[model samples]
Target chain A: MSEPILDRPRPVAARRDAALPEPQAQDPDLELVDRWRDGDESAFASLVRRHHGRTFGLLVRMLGSREEAEDALQETFLNLHRHGHRFRREARFGTFVYRVAMNAALNRRRSLGRRRAQLERLASRQAAGDDLPQSPRGPEAGVVQGELRARVQREIQALSPNLRGPLVLYDLEGLPYGEIARVLELPEGTVKSRIHRARRALRERLIDLVSESDDESEGAGQ
Target chain B: MSLRLGHRRFRDQLSDYADGQLSPRLATRFERHLASCADCRKELGELRRMLELLHDLPAAEPGPGSVDALLRRMAETEARPRRWLSAWGAPVAAAAAGLAALLLVQDVSVSIGLPGSAVRPEARSASLVAAEARALPRRPAPPAPSTAAMLGRRAEFAPATPGAPSGASSSGRSALAACIGSRDTRDCIRYHWMLDLAGRDVPAFLEVFESLPEAARPRLAGDLADLARGSGSATAIADHLRASRDPRAATLAARFAAVGRR
Candidate 1:
């Protein structure tokens, strides 16, 4: 009644040592995977440090809400922990992890439909004369970097999943076309085409933003 | 003059040409075109500039404390003992340990000190042992069939019959295919079928689906559905469903399409 065989404490490190080997000597991901397999608690921690930001950033972009992104990020890591054995070196560790993050974010998006509907209702209410004050542009006012960034983000968000996958992998993650193709399970030609299409779409959306910024700069005589 | 004129076609290859993915001969032709054509040159310049601007987009950074959280999760996962030993580990050592444990358990259970009576003579009989061995046949069992193989076999055996509700036929194969095919019928069929098949052999199906004409989607969907229902093979439905525009029929066809090769 007190304990089950499955719950028996097998030898597992409760903490990772700070003096663990340098990240270079061992492939950090492989090491962490092996350590996790062997019940080294700290190895898992190192892995989280290595990949959390990139994973979080991807979830943020995918979900477009910081709170949702955080939740998705947690879910992604939990999935990784449960499915660590599925990792094989056939794909880059980063690509594999990002794929998991993308999937988790997509799942969250699917589940958030109800919340989206609520938000839409609120948005409709706001449209009917809510007097929310607009925040000023950043310190570099004339540059409109913040505005441009928002425009770019919106344009990217507007892209279809097909185009966005390659676009984000290349532009945000800095993965080469080959890596992007491998990660997305697409042909390199298709990856290139999608990236091109995404770029073209983005350019179309941002033309006004770009021109407006240019006009503003000229008007300011700077 | 014809050769010079034909060189203009190379101008359209600039995107691939720049990446050196183009054939050497075609690349050379494109370069020659680029040298002579001002408009092509300008277009390439614009493309290059646009690409440069895209590259200049800020690199996304990971959120704070996220890495630490990930590591802690990993550590927790690692610390948990696997229910079974992996093939990569020390097999002999594991086997020996397992054998020793088994023997210890047998010894403990059979000990005369236990409250239960010592081994009954009938329990130790050769016939009894043989009967038990026959029932349990402890040699490693054959591997289970993969999900794809099982599904394929099930699909093969299941008679192809229309399962959708009456009105669903109106919205069925042909209509669905028409909707899907109009935008990218081939890709739509491939994607839909792949999803229908739970994402097996996706790339191959995608290629084939993408190559088919949009007008042919409904027919394809109807045939695929029939195939799924095991009423017909892929080849049987190919011709009749090829250009079918009936949504219900197309949906039915797609329902049975070979989503994965297996």
Candidate 2:
């Protein structure tokens, strides 16, 4: 079990905009994409600069490691550069870029073998915790927050690709359902179904943490 | 709030309702259900708070100079004389090695080595459908016809389970598309080779099939089943096992691809 969520702790949810415009409606990213396709290297560079942080955020959440996310980020943009000519008007450049980022992440994760990376990260977190100095006062909210983040990441990593892919693209990355469906090659209905299914699964797994948090919140209020 | 009405309809839509993604009518119904069901209210509260917890995980930056580094790498890539060669050098080298390996493709010693090995649980997407395919009870391979074999066979070739749909229904092209669409290059290569051998050369297909470690058979069978399942094809011979599925392989060979028309 982990600490309950009291308020927002997100620092730079740089991936999620307050208002996400639909990909098909008045896409502003396409002009840059078109320019990049026209052999404007700067256009490509600009595109990377614009979306790299967002994609990096996604990769970290999906891959669960900064180093892995960094490598996948490079692979992603490089693939984009080499294959920018293949870009279609069917998707917003952001959507297309995300699809590429996700593909690279999935490929890299497979090469290293599935779940092994996240398991290593979790074990290392425990090892790091053990290495911390013992304190007189009961450990603290930060430790609880760290553990909760790790648990959430582990649970997310534990989900199968089909399920996790849509959920991350939707909830974590803040992608619209249509874009997620496009990215995953699934129908919109299937995407929503999978998202709900994934949420149900996650809620079940973290129910203990949720209960503990609820109890803590109640205790603190009292 | 009543506890006895079994208000799961509202319960099930909690996430959607929380997100305001539900239709107005549905949302109204949910609100009505919520007003009456204390359990639903508790559940929704927990669900919303959990969602907030998920959002509490931090998003991150690519660190300073990451974009520039990627650009520099791309620029360096562009600077190379043989850009295509440099880019594809690994796959090209692997193909050369594979070609070298192909000389020994007919080498029966290598082909028989892994027929009994266990499945490695290869790719992510294959696991879900493979499990389902694995559940179908396997039928024993009947004696093969004199001409067919997995490089090592006792003259028995059965058509998967009884009444397994034959090649007429399963098109290898669709399977190839689905496999490639999966974005697993190695599996794509396997499907490519398997499709080639299955359609054009039965003996070669058998040699390659028999050469596969025992573990790979079910997964391959399962992947093919999964692929077929995607295409809405009913004739998937997914239950073919490593040992007794030899007969199933014959039908699979016939069915792994029906034609090269694609």
Candidate 3:
């Protein structure tokens, strides 16, 4: 198995802005939502800044394509704008917003069936020729990094929509099972099971990639 | 083996256990089982590794200009003038005047009489008549009854007169009938009554509509569209219509463009 890439330590100093004390008062998101409802247009922009990255990340992982993810993200925000009043603050604003984004992504996937099929076929064809025999990771890990990224992307694309949604939300997005259930409107048990199953399936698919480097090292020594 | 220690049961709870969602008692039992179970241990390890890979995938940001476009759309909608039916039209003017006269006469009759006697018979009669009219099955106009039959019925109650007041105008009845002719009308009426009867029970209405049989869905969709048009709120209706597969309902919903356009 290829050595798992250690996550680069994110700069702690950069997190200072994020760690700054949140207002000791009301929930900022609830306030922003209220402002938007009251027709203060700028309040929505604040919401976008706060959530856009996470929302975009979930979309990308769900779609497995940057362009489509971008489109879905835009639609999600637009939908939020058009239907802001429908939000009742029944749950955390994050959960409510993620649910909306996830639904939008799923709907967009259904609508893009023909295009997606064509793209998948193209992707598979590209994968066949481009599957360079696993390269050894050394001082220059660029090739290994690129190959691993591509493999990850392909495996994500291969997952069924049902499995993919929970996997992306729980695994890629690191959302808790309860929050995922809220977003997907499924029972918490169902969300957890799907995430587990999705993870198992992805590991089985990628085990060869992980093991290839070890096999190569053994052969070289022999 | 304990009843809960079977493989099928374990598999069902495995996801929950992995997610740390299992109740403490069950989790403790499961943890004990996992300590001895090699297969479960390996499975969990593999699953965790996959999750790590998934977590490493980069986040994708939305393309530029999309937010601006959305904002512009919102602005345009906000800036659009609200459309309302003009009250200056002759029919509306006449109707308003008649209603005023009816109310005035009712007030005067109530004021002139003593105590309970002040209750105007006409007003009570009008209400009873309106209730009866509303209760009648919404159907196309039936042929007029023979003069003899009318006279017989009238004689049973009050003396027959050549110019007895009609229960309701034929035109108004026909207009209402036409409105209720389709399944759409029935669904709209059902929703209207549900909403009115409970006051903005939107979730209940949605639940009812969602549970409707496939065969009835198109009609309900049409009814929703009609109601949206009538009420001058088309966004929800349009969203429903867009999600529906029935082309006919979609076409019917398209007619509600005027509601959202303004």
Candidate 4:
């Protein structure tokens, strides 16, 4: 994976302004959006550079697969190009981009689910054996931590998209409840309840996974 | 009034409290409840731990070629408009086929008349001529056309005289007088009738426009040459028709263009 320019210890702030330019950015995103609408191709490239990484991260969290996320990311930018004229100046550009990214990721996941059986059949035909490739990090780097991460990922993926979307946007992306509500087209109360419920559900599963991993570690040591 | 703050209630508050999202009153109440509840305290601690774990989830990074591939795809999409044909192609073709079937089934009458020549020679009044020469966009768009609508019911020039009730006839006559006082009654009445017809039925307006005497077309299409300023679907159709350079059609197009309705 390419290095993310916005990655820092203070990711919340970084994510918020991830679309801004690196040095002396003269124009805001709205200005760039206008220029892009007027057929300024470079303005669009500037927008892509500004938002693609953050958009890519959002797709990965929502879709939970790099290959699918990449496809969704492309679709998201293409849609932005096509429909940028519909952007209302009254709204935040970041919010608009987030809505587009979330929609593209969720839609791709929905279609991907329908195509899974067909994909599996194609995969089996190309596979040399049923055994999968090993992780490059190997099993030495804290087996319990690996299992915990894997289990957490599996549980998150298993979450209904409605609940999972709010959780990812609020917890992982640090978007406020109101913003999540707008992006998800839910009431603020619904977003808040979903976040709370999602946290409780995730905590329960993580707690169970931790206990199970502890028991296994103890058994192995004996 | 005081409300119950039981284990269930406290559990719900724990996540909001961790996020510092609770109102001051609710926070104070929850804190007061937490001061005595050990079970609630333990649950809050677990919830905070989970939040921390979630916050620490690694940010996803895109592969180096991701942006390049996206740009390439966008370029290809820009180069190939044919790809978009699939979006509306089937529906449009089906609608076209259905329209063709309808047209084939119906033996419609084709009228050939001079452009803006709807005025009956005997009924040509000075007030109607005066009303027709007024600038474009005199009134807002009429209601949308429906198949069962009485087309051109308002075509009769009802001159509004003093002491008469402000009915359709009065307004129609008043509109005619407004156009006639500014220009020739012949041109004004023709232009006014054409505008009304365009609003009522585009196909009928186009038929008359196409059949108009070439010599009288330009003189009749006053202010209608610039009818591209209207709103909604009517303006869109007007814009396409105005491109035909038919002077009478342009006059009709201007009428639809003046009204900002669908």
Candidate 5:
């Protein structure tokens, strides 16, 4: 069994605002959307720059590849540009755009037939400890953290898109379940169950990894 | 600490507990369970670490020119207009092909060479006229029955006497509308033919029906079915013709009755 890691629970509301910077005091995202609707091209560029990082990040994790995420990013923006006039003022613009990006990313992932292949590749990479993001030389603890990051990513990649999409949106992005329901177009109850299933799947994967390592060390000691 | 929580409930609360999302009452119960359960505690710790690793993964950056390329594509798309040729090109092509077929059927007025090819030249011409009527946008007014019989043609193609509804012109638009509304290829052509044939004189169609041989009865039955299927007046015409003693009329009326029930 793994030992408890002494980690404090962060405030969900604070984390939400930190991850997604609110439309600032003077310059709101809606103002940019209105300008774009009025044919201001520069307003569109500003919107893209403001939202692209998180949108691109979401797509990357959803697609499990950089190239496909890039393609989907273009599609999401193009759709927004074309249909900007139809944007309803009642809902939050950020939620609307995230919904668009999630739909486009999920569609692109399904079209490529890479869901299974991607999971298999991530699993093998996790086994080899090659799933970590590249980093310069650091302390021994950083190496361990990188490996742990790699293992988590592999398990996340292994999850089906339905489970993975909600998990990433909630756990990684720190969006509320209500916001997640808007993004995924799912009921709040469904989103909750999916997140719970996703965490369970990830924990099970970790437990399996731990057991295998324990067996390996015991064999080596004998 | 009084009630021991089951493993199923422990697993369900683990995700919410890690994120501090569980309600305060539920959280208290979960904490009570955690004190006594080492297994649940280890799993909760693992869930926390998993959440941390997910959050720690670096956000991906969009490559340069991503926006510029999409904007350029959008501009290209806006510059193009949606056109009728792009939208209805396939159907227009099909209509043209149908028109060409009607012309070909008209050209081949002679008796076709087939085994037991005993069909009269006039009957063959009548069938071609039927196909042509289906191909045309509007059915032409018919000649008088006396004139048609004198010309050696079927009497059903005769012009209407005064005071009748003039089924040919009256029902032409409705049948054409049906043709447009229906997706079935065979039904569209059949409805078009029936409307054109009876559109001139309803009884004239029965007169023509009575004269056709056994081999042509099945098609006549199907046409009657199509006509009766669409309009109440056509159903009435079929019922009116049902009392006829002629075998062909009986077959056509039976088909009309069968279709009307449906």
Candidate 6:
């Protein structure tokens, strides 16, 4: 639970960008991709249906808006449908999916238009009198924690996309350094360095949290 | 100074060490450093705590049925023919662009060219200025129908001249679509759509031209190529259209014995 916190039943404020966890040894899902490449369109659909939740969960955190993430999701799979043939099978197909999904999220983010916040949407959801799925300590503690969480999100968003991409992939999505390197077309060492730099920047910005121990906070790591 | 640099290097490895990513030997060395360095221990504890908080953020789920919606869109897109201009090679696209540019220079429909601009906008008669206003794109933005589409739109807004072609109104809509924003193509396309007396009835005249008998394609192609230069013969090319199934082709046949299909 100190790592991936994906076991929630209700909507928690999700992090923005994430990727599917790729197997370090081999890509077992290459057969599914091969089936789609061989004109078994149903395999593609099954992949879309299966992976949509995880890909979208990551993108919403990455793009900072559910609506934009949804659009990015469509672009991701459509790109796969159109150009998945270009996938040389060098990396795990799961890793390839992450690359496409991440690229779509980043490209859509860079596209000349408005940027929206996931927190703003969550606030709207809250305004509708809907309680978030978890984080129930006390109302007073919840509000303060919520403000700190929003600040953390903004600081993460403010990081350069270069630092942000690797950090989100490694820390939030829980992809390994090697898989992240393949997805980002960077050296694994570069990916590790970027993640570390991103972490330091985030830590420096949220340094006040260092004084206040998170170990006592409700489900801080889980 | 050496100890300080060593401490700084250990701090750099702190991220790797906290993630339990370093090799065992490096980890042992880092452990040795951490045993004495209170600063490194405190920093590692803070880093671990921060990393945990980040990991604890909740997940964002997809809206209900987004996958189904995506699949439906995929099916719909597959059903339709692709719309990109990739089919036409660079040469044809270049030719089309050149034709579009040529028509732009001679744009008489909006009177931005010689005959139109001959009279200054300020000095033009009130009635003429009023007529031009309706045709000019001086208002807020419209949709992208693109550069050519905008031109076609402006052409519709243009005031019709006295003694203009007999079927100008009938061809206006088709001309609006076929204009590609060029007055020459608009005039050419509108003229063809105008009469049983002249051009074929295809809205996508270029597409229709592609479908014609190979012998006939070059005949019309020659006319179309020379169209910008104003040297094309519309009369001879109509003879090639006798086999065209369009009802309008009949009028073209009757006129083609005398007129060159320019």
Winner by lDDT? 5
Q: Across residues B2-100, which tens digit of lDDT does each residue of candidate 6 receive?
A: 999999999998887777666777877877777667667667766876876787676777777666666544432322222213443222232232222
Better of 1 and 5 by lDDT: 5
Lowest summed lDDT window (length 10), candidate 1 chain B: B87-96
Candidate 3: chain B TM-score equals: 0.26
Worst 10 residues of 2 chain A by lDDT: A1-10
Model 4: docking quality category: incorrect
Clashes of each: 36, 11, 3, 20, 4, 18
Deviation in angstroms for A6 in model 3?
20
DockQ for candidate 3: 0.14
Interface C-alpha RMSD after superposing true interface residues, each candidate, one decimal:
23.9, 14.3, 14.5, 16.3, 15.4, 15.3
Q: Tell me the tens digit of each residue's lDDT in model 4 across A1-222.
A: 101111111223345346333323343687887766554556676688788998888888887678888888878877876666667754467777889999997787678665784674454333312222233132244445544444455567657778889999888887777678777778989998998888878777555322223343333223
Give the distance in Å from residue A158's predicted Cα in candidate 4 to where it truly belongs.
Answer: 1.3
Which scores better on TM-score, 4 or 5? 5
DockQ agreement of candidate 6 with the native complex = 0.13
Which candidate comes out best when scored by DockQ?
A: 5
> Per-residue CA lDDT of candidate 2, range B1-262, in tens?
5544447656668777767767767766776666656555556666665687788878877777566555543433332223223333322222222321221222221232323223221111122112212322322431333212221221111223333432222343344445555645344534443433343344445655555556656666556545544444423333322223456465553443442112
Ranked candidates (lDDT, high to low)? 5, 2, 6, 4, 3, 1
Candidate 3, position A48, lDDT? 73
- For model 3, the docking class works out as incorrect
* Recovery fraction of native interface contacts for candidate 4: 0.31
State the displacement of the C-alpha of residue A46, model 1, in Å, after optimal TM-score superposition: 1.8
Per-prediction TM-score, please? 0.44, 0.52, 0.48, 0.50, 0.51, 0.52
Per-residue lDDT tens digits for candidate 2, residues A1-222, read 112113213322233443566665888877887765553445666787788899899898888889989889888876876666667878777878888988998898788854776776667556445633232122253346576577678778767677778878878878777778877767999998898888888777556545434454444333
DockQ of each: 0.08, 0.15, 0.14, 0.15, 0.19, 0.13
Q: What TM-scores result for chain A when each predicted structure is judged separately against the true chain A?
A: 0.68, 0.75, 0.75, 0.69, 0.72, 0.70
Q: Once superposed on the true structure, which residue ranges of model 6 sit more than 4 Å away at CA?
A: A1-26, A112-145, A212-222, B76-262
